[model samples]
Target: MTSQSESTEPSSALHDEQAPVKRVRVAAWAADPLTLNGLTQALMGRLDVFVAAGELPADVDVLVVAADRVTSEVMVSMRRAAAQCSAPMVLVTNELDRTRLLGAVECRVVAVLHRSAATEERLISTIDVVAGGGGLLPPNLLGDLLRQVQNLQEEVLTPRGLNTSGLTSREVDVIRLLAEGCDTEEIATRMCYSERTVKNVIYAMTSRFNLRNRPQLVAYAMRTGII
Candidate 1:
């Protein structure tokens, strides 16, 4: 009996060590108190998430902004909040256009969900993904985003010989895969390159463009029509 108890204790400890960490610290902001309160209630309890109050905390994993519309004023507020911390933002808004979407990208918003479609499950899942360093957008918004990038490239960058989206053809390929959710090893395997090469490509892009991280790189590619 003593030997069995000792063996079980080690196994239990290993299980504890292997358990996934689910706690995510979140901060929410909105022009309307009702919207903010609704989002707060939706995110309460599940996935071990904790929603905090006041200005965005530096340690927060995600920032959720509930807006009836994506106006210039809203964008300014978002930019201010983003300046305080580097947390990814999930914007729930009623409308998005090329201009506003570009503004949101500039503010480092990785996810956008329409007010009508912002179900509790979807909101929670989006927070989880953005917290884990991923980007999310509705399919229609994604199409519009790509179109906006193309228009900018053709009209602005191409005439100035700055077309290559500030990246070489090979670099574009790597970033495209990254936007498609490929990790370093997966990208290397798909592109027939070494893991170090993949890392170098990403490093060069971020360093050259002064981007914050991979998600920012992907957003840059989208804004430039490189992906």
Candidate 2:
């Protein structure tokens, strides 16, 4: 057998280097320049080594936004960014309301950070995880969101003997029309059915689902996405 030295090639004078070809794409929407700059700087630095090593491609990976502005206008902008890029939105905000945060969640925001967060580690972890099709939220906010959903389920729904899962199409339509101020006559007219037919449909729906009344049916339809 050959000696170990004979089996190995001599070292080259120049090192063969590889650069990252793909990276986690991210879009950030924040309310302030300072916040935007801090976030961008942190992300860039943290991803630098991976970027340089060809693990990330320029087209497939990027920081799509570093906005120095935020408004209701930015909501549209953020949604457009999320849509066009097919990447998650990260909102860095000073105060995040549960109501608006739900809207953000609907638009596919997978990560959120406070403007005052001192480091990007959490944010970076969120980005990486979301890029890999996972989700993350701040502990307090996640709990609050869960509570909000639970409260809606328990208070507005459970007390009325309605669950979100048990609504049907005709029942949903009737309830939506009810919520829109349509009386029985108007609902029958709008649905192209006779008043008696509409009443019969509603009656059958209530009996089949064991719903108490129109109000309960309306609340159930809205909660369950049946309407």
Candidate 3:
């Protein structure tokens, strides 16, 4: 005969236990040895460390890249590192401007922390966001990012008849016609283009995106919100 209290105590203990949290896998890179050691030490225990001599671990969830200045040389190295690891990056820097901010995007960097303001808690929290497919940037960096997008759109993409989705105006018109079940000759007639020109447009889009057929291209347009 077991006492009711004994039975209840075990049940209470079971209820109190919690599942262990899964830690984010984090790797650190810096232009110099001292900064590298500092970042790795700061992130220890809070994250699962991934380190290798030659390459970043394929399973790393996030990478922290620290630099004194986000200059062209540092950005070049960061770009190479970003190529090696497809994981999102958190950049810690002493200085960053609009041009440098755009360069950071090229390196897959999702978060930017000013070196002066980045405490361990802040850095860890930023890494967690990047690991979760979210990002945080300071107000200044946010402004810079917006400016970069506007400039790129106004100066480059817009002039080329393209939008953020990388689809040109003509491409969008053709895709819209296709989605409306318009055949090539009908699309050409509606758009005042020759049938051969419409065919060339479709072929160009298919080749660019590697889509196999008209149906697939239409599906892609739908998926990408271009039509």
Which stretches of candidate 3 lie above 4 Å from their native place? 1-19, 173-203, 209-227
Give a tens-digit lDDT track for model 3, residues 109-131: 89999999899999998998899
Query: Whole-model lDDT, candidate 2?
Result: 0.63
Query: Order of candidates by lDDT, top first?
Result: 3, 1, 2
- Give the per-residue Cα lDDT of candidate 2 at 201: 74
Q: Across residues 94-184, which tens digit of lDDT does each residue of candidate 2 receive?
A: 6666766666666667766665672567767766776676776789889887887788778877776556554445656777888898889
Clashing pairs in 3: none
Ranked by TM-score, the better of candidates 1 and 2 is: 1
Give the better candidate number (2 or 3) by lDDT.
3
Clashes of each: 0, 14, 0
Residue 88 Cα positional deviation in candidate 2, in Å, after optimal superposition: 1.7
- Residue lDDT tens for model 1, 1-227: 56754653456666668666658888888878788788888887674444444466668888889889888888888999888878888999987766787778778898999899899988888988998899899888888888888888899877765554565677888898998999999999999999999999899999999999999999988887777
- Each model's C-alpha lDDT? 0.83, 0.63, 0.88
How high is the lDDT of residue 122 in model 1?
87
The TM-score obtained by model 1 is 0.63
How well does each candidate superpose onto the true structure, as a TM-score? 0.63, 0.49, 0.78
